[model samples]
Each structure stands twice: as structure tokens, then as C-alpha cells.
Target: MQEEAYHIPVLLAECLEALQIDPAGTYVDCTFGGGGHSRAILDKLGPDGRLVAFDQDADAAQNLPDDPRVLFVPHNFRHLQRFLRLHKINSVNGVLADLGVSSHQFDEAERGFSIRFDADLDMRMDARSERTAAQLLQTYSEQQLHKLFEQYGEVTNARTLAKTIVTLRATMPMQTIQQFKAAIQGVVKGNPNKYLAQVFQALRIEVNDEMGALKQLLEQLPEVLVQGGRAAIITFHSLEDRLVKQFFKQGSFEPEEDHPFENKKQVSLLKVITKKPIVPTMEEQKRNSRSRSAKLRVAERI
Candidate 1:
């Protein structure tokens, strides 16, 4: 199990440069998949520098580097502040989170994170999670499915797809990948591969509560990092990219409807570093197709 094979860190050099690593500064790798970025951060750190690496998926534990300067926490980055305080740290100099599923999760057939697989409809990033993708199909109402497909997957035929699932699941079993794909075969629109991938992406997002966790992590950034400390986040989809972009630009997930502070002004907490999101180069994308969708945005805590 090589580190690169587990997960090829996307925009590695860009992330390192974004962090602007200081030798004795403390940092956090919110999603320490393969420890790729963390390892690079360590290379620039002096002996006194510390890195707090967090990963909810147990699989990533194996890829963690054996270094005294690194402290591995087996928890989701949503608990970033708690974990940092528990370790007697007040603030970090920089934070990095690559919010993409690792290659290892997709490569393993049993993970159900890939569209190419025919395993159980279980796409839990953290295996300890009780809900599975199959359960969502079995339990979600038609409207719920429609909204999920429409908003999360942006499926053009979301309503029809939801109706189809609601109609079929009563008689047909979609407890596995093969069963689900076959069940929805007739309704697939556009490219078969791309359509199915979108559906799977929606399921994975809901099952793992990824967006919720990300919001929690972002909200903690201002409190956990020192002034001028950088936070570099790499997002894979537009939904995530938009969230990061908005937070960086305005320092809040604003413009929400009927919320308590919908119209209230929020003092900006972050100063945008990258005027535009950084995307992978052609050479990197050619080397790893998965990096194509990645967009890196950075901001400094104000």
C-alpha cells in the first residue's frame, strides 16, 4: 500500500505554497488522506513545528507518516476546534483540507464509492456510520429524492428519476450497486457513465453528510487559526467550491432565507488570498484524471 496509490494529493505544490509554511508554526491537515500534503508540510517545518492530522476514515491511518511532529486524530474535521483545544493548542498557523474522496475508497470494490463497482450500496466514508446508500433509496420520499437529485447531483431529469425510484423500489431490490443501476437503466439520461456518476455522487454526499461536516470545519477556521493564518481548501464539485468561495469572499455562508442573521452584517473573518481558484495543470490532470475537477481556494484569517 503505497501512499500515492492510496490518494494522489491534488494540487500538491499549489497547496504547499498557499500555506506559506513557517518552520516553527503549527498547522492542521483536516483531511489527511494518504498524509500526502502533511508529509510535504513536515518537510518545510523545523523540529518544533507540529501538524495535527485528522481523518474519519480508518483506512487513511495506515498511510500516516511516523513522525514525532505529527499528531494523528481519528475523527472528522468537523471537530477541528475541539481536537485542537484538547491537544492544548490555542491556534494553528495554517490549515489544509482536500475535500475529495481518496482513490483507495474508489479502488476497493466493497466501499461502494465508485460507479464501476457492483458491491453493496454502502458509500460510508466513515464505516461507523449507520446509514448506507441503499437505505436512502429505500426510505427517502419522492420529494426528498427529487430535491437530492436536483440540488446535490443537479440531475436534469431529477423529478422523473425520483418518480422512477419511488415506483420501482417497492417491487425491485436496489440493495447493491448492480441492482440499483439495473433498476434505473431505463431512465438514465445523457452519457450513461456520467449520469450514473452524478447519482452516485448525490448518494455519497448524503450518506456521509459531507457538506454538513465541511460547513462545520469552515466555521471553525477563524477561531482555530491565528491572525493572518492561511486556510487552503480544495473542493471537487461546484456545490463545495461555491461554499468555499462565498465564505472566503464574504466570511460567511450568507444570503440564506429567513435565517436569524439573513440581513445582519457579518464582520469578515477571512481575507481572500487567491483572487481565483487554482485548478490542476494539464500535465497533472493527464497523470491523474481524478484531479481534473479539483479547485483550490485560499484565505487568511483576519
Candidate 2:
């Protein structure tokens, strides 16, 4: 896919400003989806500067620029620390992660990320991973599905939806997008499109374990970023935004037992750069409808 059409970097200028690019320092782009943000970061980096970019999607590798200064890692950002050490890098001058699902992924009918298409119910960002949305739906207990829909998707009739899924799975197959949608038709609440979108969002997040991966990345920030270095995260969902906001402001995330870092001294090691998330300008939202929900939060490692 062409970089231009693959994904438009949301809040482009704001993200660059947040990084305060030091031409000779090293940087990290945790989600090198379309390479849009990475390419822009590269423009600000001098020849001696380095950029370590990461993405699990094989499609992303196709967009890698022909530059020796960049070290691209074909893995999820959750493994940020592991890969950084593997490459003999201890700290970075700045870090960025745009946590939005790329337009390319949604537009590609076969990926099953969008509600518009009828395809295999697979929402894996990395094809190498075995879990798929179909597997979750077929296997999860009714209570588990209820919790997923309620917590992740905020589906209005989540409990009912879960019950319906359990009741239907016994007699019908829910192996594809069309099949699942048809199966859940009787219980969809409010707007059909919006309801299905929420349902899909929950499944996608669970199948990929997005929140888990994000927490891992956040926990690594204090260790991987140098003092005064910046972390600019762009989150599309409120839940993801809240996690970043809390981690940047408090250096802690939800669920103490599930915390990614063992060294959680309950003290924040970063300074919040944006008092509130910087949202896309009206002009940008007009140009790209997908960017309307985007929120950019920047913080400096203290």
C-alpha cells in the first residue's frame, strides 16, 4: 500500500512539536503503520540521528523507507524494551505511538476490521498471531462475552447480546463477519451501524489484547526514555486515552496486580506536556473523518 493512502498521520504538526526533535538524538515510533509519522520524524532527524520504528503488521514492512538511519522492528510495541536492548540501545530521546487502527486496515475488506465488509472474523494486527475474533466468539463464556462487550465496547445491550451469542452458537456457525452480524441481528441496540461498530471494537481489542500491549509499552517508557525525552501518544479511544493520560500524569495504570512494571514505586517519572489532549483541528477532521476522535497527549521523562 502507498504510504499516502495507507494512513494519514493525525495531528501531524502537534506531534512533531511535542517531540521537539533534536536532530542528532535517537527516537522511537512504536506504531509504524503507514510510516507517515516515521517519515515525518525522519525529516527532522539529521543524518547522524537514529529512529527505531516498530509494527507487527507484515503489510507495514512494505512501506519502510530506504534509509540506513532507521531500524525497523517487525513486532508489537509491547516488546519495545526487549528489542531496544537487543539492538544495544539503552535510551531514546523521544517516543511516539499512534494507537489508532489505520484506515488501510479498515478499508481492506478481508482483514475484518471494518463493519462495512463481510469477511473472515479476523482482526489481528499481526497475522502471525493465532487468535481471531471468530475464535473468541465461538469459545468465550456468556459472562465473559458480556464483560467484554460491556467494558470494551460499551454496547448498550451487552448482557443480552452475550446471552444471545451463547444461545445461538450451539446451533449456528459464527465464523465470518456476515455470519456473526446475522446471528446478533435480533439484539442490536440503538443505531445499527454504531452498535455493530462497538461490538467489533470490543472483539478487535480482545483478540489482539490491545490494552495489555499498550500497558507493556507504557511501563517501559520510564526505562527506555532519557530524562527530558518526550513521549507523544495519539489514542483514538477514550479508554486508551485515559490509560495514557494516567500513565503520563501519575506513572501508574489501572489494575495494580496486572501492572506491567515491577518497579512501580507509585511515583510519576514524566511531566505532562499537554494539560489536555491536543485534538485535531476542524480543518483536519474535515479532511479526514477518521481523525475526528483522535487525541494527542505528550509527556517528558523527568
Candidate 3:
């Protein structure tokens, strides 16, 4: 068997601590990339305790634990509630989600997740998925591309970037990372690699519907967690962290509505456990540059 690719867990100690582990309690690792967090949760679990893990990437299935106590669900974390129910689990004691593309996904150049490497324009986290970055570039309207780049990537020149793609794709589709990079040659600012990296990141986010999937995952948190059960979410981008932070605080994407007496009713779903996000230690950041962007937030069921 081929060795399973690995992703170094970010904020390892902090996540283990934030979980406030009950060795006899059941827990869930919603994003089991490389099984790092799942391994930790299992290590802390007693014989009676159970750990269920989920990952959309088929590549991660290799990391699934052989222990009977650890159940691996080969699906997206967005389907948390349904899968938990199917497994006969009504509610869990704790849930942990390490969101965004895994390091292994980026390191494998053929996945086209990293602009630093030349590869196909395929950025689907789940290979079974039909949509690829090139397909999105081929079909998405210029306005749609603009919105995707601006909203997902926070790209400063999204308008021009979108126009550039549409203009270039008219003659030939931007199918490879090299072609796409060449197309955007003029707009690249500061460092070429960094600028292309941001553009590729934007495309990958759009292709995967990452924000949509994240919203779905957040919506199901209230349903999956038992009373007092905590959820630890590790987000690598401001966009993902903002949604997690806001939902934990307000319980929904929409603003809390006022009652008849003009008082806003308290959202009973979750109590934000972390007033501020937990960040990586200086040592971890130095050892792994990927750890620098991670932000971990914890919340508990009310």
C-alpha cells in the first residue's frame, strides 16, 4: 500500500486543550485531514469513548483508523448531521473542524492547489466532484468570476482579473496553471509567485464552493452538538474565520430579529467559548509557514 500523505496539524496543543476532553465522552473530528486531530482525540478517549471523523477528500481515507472506536465517514463535513444520524449518534460531546484545503492537497502538484507548482487547473478537493477550476473559468460569466474572486479571495483587482480571464478564454481556455499564469502576467503585482498564488486560491475557493459548504457545516452545528458540547473550528483564512466567529456570536448569518417588545431574543444554539481566536505559537509558525494563517475558535452548545 502507498504511504498516506500527511498534513501537520496546526495549533495542536491548543486544540487538544480547547476540547476540554472527557475521556469517556464521544467526540467528532469533522475534518480528519491526515487523521492528525482524530489521532489526538482517540489518544485522549477512554475505552468507552468513541471518535467519529469525516473528510471529503478520498485521499484522506488512507488515514482512517483501524480501531473500532474510531468511525470514519467518507463524506464532506457539510453533511455532519445526516452522517451522525446514520451512525446512530444523536448528539456528540465535542466537534472539531479544521477547514480549508489540506497541506497534502497543495503539496501534490497535480492537484493544482499551489501556484508555486505547474500543474493542471484541477482544484477539486473531492476528485469525484464534476466541477474543476478550468470548467468554472470556461463557463462562469465575467461578473460571476469577478464576484467569486472579490468575495472568496479578497483580491484587490478582482474586476480586472475577471475581465482578463474572460478576454483570454474567448480564444483558448485557461486549462493549465501555466496558461492561467501567463494570461494574468500583466496584473501580477509585487512578487509574481505571490500574485498568482492569490489568483489560484480565489479560483480554487470558487470551484469547490468552499464558503457554501462552510455555511452548511455551521448551520448543522446546533443540531449535532449536545447541551454543553463544545465545537472547535480551525480556519486558515479571514473569510472562513469571519463566518465562524459571526455565527458563533449571533447564531445565524442574518442579524438577530427584534421581538414584539423590541428586545432581540438570545440565540440559544451556541455560547461563544473563545472571546478571541487562538493563534499558532511563534515556534509552530517558524517550523511551518502554513500554520501562520490558522485561527481557531471554540463554542459550546447552550
Candidate 4:
């Protein structure tokens, strides 16, 4: 595996602007991928300012900042609240989270995050994590597989695909990306690239329990942020973006119910700063195509 940083830090400038850095204040970067955003945040902070970065992947520790103002936490961002409290931090000026698999994770073929490369079926972002994609495939029932394929992968033939997996697992355990691909070749409808990518994405998400982790992290944001503190999140998928959007706008995951007898008081702990998400500029897309789908949503604590 490459030891140096591998991620390009999509929409770098936009993220910085959304964060609205305070030179004397403290900040937390929940996803310290390749340290790109962390470095940027540090640049905008003063000598007294502090930056606490968190990355679950042990490999990411190599890129830790050397300055005393920066603190590195080798744990999942889902533990944001517990860790923050440990540092005697009740609130922060800004928080940034660039969610999803980092470029470094995708570049390493052995990590098994991308479909472009032939690698092991292990898709754990944190190598120490117990579950692998293969184990998940082997253990998940047909109905569970169907739900994952349909909800996460958006595969059109989820039912047939799940049924096929159940049949194949009876004879053999799907252990590698190549093996999984080969086993499901019969159900790949059209456009191999698109179909395979979706399947791999679904597996990766499940292996990492990404959505669950993200929800846990988001839930802590309200309590961890001070009044007017900012949280700038960059989500790459519709599901994540929608969750962030809804939370920032309405203060809760579920839609609000109308009450005729009472005035609608805002339950929201955050004020959505971005009426709509900020997308990468065309110039940025040309420079770093990985940023094309990046969506930035900023919110201020209420």
C-alpha cells in the first residue's frame, strides 16, 4: 500500500468557504482523508486555534499533522461526541465531514472498494474492522441481500440477484471481488461498469455500516456545536445528502406534522446555511473529476 496521501480533497475551496474558519476558534474534521481538508483548516487557524481530526483507518495516521494545534484521533467519526468530550470540548466553531470512502481507500486494490480493479472481497475501510464483504455476502439472507441491493445499490434485478447469491453460497463462499463478480454475472442486466459499480458500492456501504455511522455522527452535531457554530458536510450520494438536508432544515429525520392548534415552533437545532447544496465548479471538475458529484451542505447551530 502507498504510504503517502492519495486523496485530492474534492471542492477544497468551497468547503473552506462554507466552514467560515475562525483564526482563534476550534474546529473538528470528522473525516481526515489524506489530511487535505485538515491542512486547509490549519492554514486558516491561528497559533492558538485548535484542529481535532478523526479517521478510523490506521493507515491514515501516517498523514497526521505535526503542529501542536492539531490533534489526531484514530477512531471512527461516529464516536464524535465521546471523543470531543474527552478533550474537554463542549462545542466547536466549525466541523467538517467529507463522507464516503476516501480516494486512498479506492486506489488500493487490496481494499476492494472499487470495481475497476480485481482485489480481495475485503471492503472494510478500517482494516481492523472484523466484518468483510465476503463474510457479509456469506451470512446475509436472501431478503436482507435483496434490501441491500435494492436500497443501496439501486440494482434493478435485486430479487433475482439475491436469489442467485443464496443459491451460489450454498455451494461456495464468495470470497473475492472477482469471485462475487463471476457468481453474479448472470444477473448483470446491461452496462457492466454501471451495474458492477452499484453492486460494489452496496457491499462497501454494508461492510462499513456507513449510513448507520453517519447518522450517529450527525445526531451528535447539535449538542457538540455552539450557537452559530458551523457544520459543513460533503456527501457523495443522494441518501446521505437527503439525510443531511432534512436534518439541517427541519431539525429531525422525519417530516413535520401540521398542528392547527399551535404555532409551528422550530424544533431544528440547526439553521441550514445552504438553501441548496454547493456543487463543484466546472473548473474544479476538470482539475479533479472525483469532485464532480460532491455536494456541500453548511448549517449553523440554532
The weakest ten consecutive residues by lDDT in model 3 span 1-10
Candidate 1 lDDT by residue in tens digits, 95-138 = 99999999999999999989887899999989888999999999
Higher-ranked by lDDT: 1 or 3: 1
TM-score of each: 0.96, 0.96, 0.95, 0.95
| Tens-place lDDT digits, model 2, residues 1-302 | 68879999899999999999999999999999999999999999998999999999998999999999999999999999999999999999999999999888999999999989999999999999999999999899999999999989989899999999999998988989999999999998889999999999999999999999999999999999999999999998989999999998888885445457676556789999899999999999999999999999999998
User: What would the per-residue lDDT of candidate 4 be over residues 150-263, giving only the tens digit for each residue?
Assistant: 988898999999999999987865788878888988889999989988888888888889989988888889999888899999999888899899888887777777899988
Assess each prediction's global lDDT (C-alpha) against the native.
0.93, 0.94, 0.86, 0.88
Scanning candidate 2 in windows of ten residues, the lowest lDDT window is 254-263
Q: What lDDT score is found at residue 295 in candidate 1?
A: 99
Give candidate 2's error at residue 206 in angstroms. 0.2
Residue pairs with clashing backbones, model 2 = none
State the TM-score for model 4: 0.95
Clashing pairs in 4: none
lDDT score for candidate 1 against the true structure: 0.93
Model 3 sits at a Cα RMSD from the real structure of: 2.0
